[model samples]
Target chain A: MSGVRVLVGTRKGAFVLASDGKRERWDVTGPHFGGWEIFHLKASPADPNRVYASQGTSWFGQLIQRSDDGGKTWEPVGNKFVYDGVPGTHLWYDGTPHPWEFARVWHLEPSPTDPDTVYAGVEDAALFRTTDGGQTWHELPGLRTHESASSWAPGAGGMCLHTILQDPSRSERLFVAISSAGTFRTDDAGKSWRPVNRGLRSEQIPNPTAEVGHCVHRIAMHPSRPGVLFMQKHWDVMRSDDAGESWQEVSGNLPSDFGFPIDVHAHEPDTIYVVPIKSDSEHYPPEGKLRLYRSRTGGHEWEALTNGLPQRDCYVNVLRDAMAVDALDPCGVYFGTTGGQVYASADGGDRWTPIVRDLPAVLSVEVQALP
Target chain B: MIRVVLPAHLRKLAHVDGEVTLDVEGLVTQRSLLDALEARYPMLRGTIRDHVSQQRRPFVRFFACEQDVSHDAPDAPLPAAVATGDEPFLVVGAMAGG
Candidate 1:
């Protein structure tokens, strides 16, 4: 019988939750690097046994931990993430030029074909790649050195490169998203990048339709259909049919479009998920109800999946990296909340169950469906 | 043997129960002691200080003979007591941000 491993990163540590394909009766493992903040944990698609974790703290700084035996054992790897050259400057919150500084690793994306190759999206917003499996990291440099980089400012959460997507159909194509600096795509494998935010509009910035200042919260692409990308912006849930060349608003009929953590279904290319918070200012669910909205036809139509979720007085928020889906038969959906709950739905989003009720406010959730 | 006391988190990370002892070949100083400690426990490299700049992290401090020597030069020799192992050199995580 196959099983699914849910790798969860929380403010305190990392946890591994394992369950058979039945999706019931889980065995929980960690608090792995206890007392440290684990921003993200991901299993390599080519090698499930190789798991990478981004562990750090404000005082202790950043450390990357890798587990070779499927989260059973781990060792600290390289933590050095110096920029490619003399790090120049990007726009500060006050519109003043500020030197680029390394803050923390926000996301880790392992190569789809090689376990030893991984990409890291970091705060202060830059992309770094490691070829010898987390042993060393070098900045990609092209994305940060774009002409518009000087005008890229930090979002409310600090300027962070939070989303990384490698095109499954094209080896040379890759996409990365940065908060306060829209989406960027590299067709020649990080050699050069171009901003792909033609249709994104943010009222907070002076130029609502500027080429690079929109705060994109998250972007998700189904592995089977890499060209169709879905994004949950700071204020709208969007969809791009031509690989982010242009995006159209799909927030139609949802209670509130201001939300984070958008994801695609395991088997269905047109199906997607998003948690609609009340608004940007109110980071909780609308009307105190926790709902996981699912759109079977991509977007413009959605239904609330709230059978086992809290429906009243629940004010916790779901972060951009907190939602994930396992490619198990019948499709298993998982998400973590700020109130320290990890919920799983065995049969798509029809129902829900909490795998672990209390943890240190989950930051990211990734699932691996084993054969 | 030079005695060094690491912060609680570092101690946990290094999996050491108490003060760690290392053999320092040259005159015991903050830089030399930390170099030996990180060499012995490779995981603790960037925790105490930066990997590139090698500057003491803002919240990390050094103490010997109950004196704050964090601002002191990294190459400065330690107090006699610490050098002689009579008083263990302490690496403290400053009491700020919870």
Candidate 2:
């Protein structure tokens, strides 16, 4: 009997929720590194037992923690993330050039085939790769040094490379999304990169449909259809069938397309999920109702999954990295809210239940389907 | 042996139950003492100070013998009480941010 391990990173610490294959009952452990801010925790695809966590605080700076025996034990690993050369400058919020600074790691994406290889997306909007587990990280500076680098400005939440998606069919190609820098895809591993924001439009920027200035909140892809991608942008939901070459508005009939996280189901290539929030300025749910919308036709058409979710007076916001899915039989969908609730829907998106009601305000959630 | 008191979070990270003790190798200046401390507990690096700059972090402060030594030059010698191990050096995480 296999099991599932859900690794949750929160504003204060990290937690692990484990359950049998049935996905009925769960066992919770943690508050690991109790007073620290765990930005993200992800397990390696090659080996389910290997996990990498990004822990930090405004007082203590950043530290990377690695777990070898699932979440049972952990050890501090290399946290040094030095840029390759002189990290110059990117555009400030006020349109002035500001020097690039190393902040915190926003996302940890372990390699699909190698446990030792992982990618770290960080604030100041940059990408780094570590081939020695979490021991060392070296930036693939091409993304940061792009021709339009000088004009890249920080979004409201600071310029952060918060989303990383790998093409399961092609090991050499990778995709990363920044807070305000739109999306970039690297075809030759991490050496070279290109911006793929053709159809993205942001009303906030002076130019609504620029090449690289759109604030993309999150992007998700199903393994079965690597070329097809879905995005929850700052204002609209989008879909791309040409591997991000161009995107089309898929916000369709949803109440309000403004959302943080977007995800695709494990087995259903055309099925996807997004929690619709009120607006960009107001991060809470619309009408104070927390609803999870599922689109069966990939995009444009959606149905609200409100069976077990809060329908009235629920103002909690789900962050961009707080939603993930496990590869169980019915395909388990999991998401954590800013109100410190982790909800699960074992049967697609019909019904839901809380794994743990109150924890630190959840930051990121990742799931590992055990063999 | 010189006594050092770390902040609550640093203590948990360095795995020190109480005030830690360190043997300074050379002239007991602020820089030398911290070098010894980091050498003994490598995990404390980049927490109290930066990895490349080697400067005390903005929110981190240093005190010795009831004197604030955070703004003092790194190479300046510490007070005799701290050098003699009678008074412990203190590293504090400033109470800042929300």
Candidate 3:
């Protein structure tokens, strides 16, 4: 029987929500590594049973956990993430240069073909790779050591490399998104990188369209159309069709474009989803109504999908990594909110239901469809 | 047997209950006891101390005989009460965070 597993990372810990193909009646097993913050959890596409989690606490520093039995059991692996060379420095919030420091892992991207290979996007804006199934990690320093890196500054939420995307058709091509540093691409693997923020404009910075220094919240792409990318910037919704060589504004009619998470539909290459928050500073639904906007035509034309979401008195915010889509036949959409609710829709985004509630504030959500 | 009391979170990570007892082969100092502790509970390596510096974590404190031994030298000999197992060496997660 086919099933779906939703790996949720929360402010407090981690939770694994499971269900059969029916897409109802979820079994929640959770609070794993309780009292500790679970930043992200992901399963390998090559081996679904193999999983990776970024577990850490303010006092204990960072630790990586690996599960071979599909989240039923886990073992601690290597957690040491040291930057290469001297690490140098980057611009601070006050325009003063500050040394790069390791804060936490913000996202985990597992290899599409190797369960033992994974990429960790970490705070202070650096990328680390683990090929020995989380036992050890080495920094892919090209992104951080770029010529423009010294001017990179932290966003409101620390300088973080929060997104990692690999080209489905090109094994050597990869993309990474960093807060306040814009997006970068590596065509020759991790050895070299270039800033691809030419079309991205951020008024918050001195130069609206500088080479870097854009606060990009999140970026998503459809596996079938890897060249086309959709992004939820700090204040705008954008689309890039030239493999991130350039981008264009597609915010269109969203009640507000200052939101976090952005995800593409499983089957529809042109369909994408975004939860528009009131503003970057406000961080809540508009008029206390929670709505998930859907763009069937990829960005410009969008429709509000609020059939089962809160219509009033809702103030929760969805994070950049809190939304995901399962590869089931009907294509399930899942997202977690700061209010500790994980909502799921079986028939795309038509209707929704909360699978589990009263969890810690959700940080990220990733789903896997079992065959 | 040198008795050690880990904080709640460390206790959970090490998967031990109550107090953890270890056999320190040499003079019991902060360095010696920590060496045995990490040897016994490998997962606790970088929790109480740093991985490279081996310095006690800022928010982690050490107490022995009701004294704040967190400032004590790593190689300095521990109090006789802790060495003799009369009082367990305490590892506390400093009063911090929400």
* lDDT scores of the candidates, listed in order: 0.94, 0.92, 0.94
Candidate 1: regions farther than 4 A off = none
Interface RMSD for each of the candidates: 0.8, 0.7, 1.1
> What TM-score would candidate 2 get against the native?
0.98
| lDDT per residue as tens, model 2, A114-232 | 99999999998889989998888899898998888888988888999999999999998999999888899999987888999999988878889899899899999998899999999
TM-score of 3: 0.98
Q: lDDT score, residue A168, model 2? A: 90
TM-scores, chain A, per candidate:
0.99, 0.99, 0.99
lDDT per residue for candidate 1 within B42-96, as digits (tens), equals: 9898888998899998889989999999999989999989988899999999899
Two-chain DockQ for each candidate model: 0.78, 0.78, 0.68
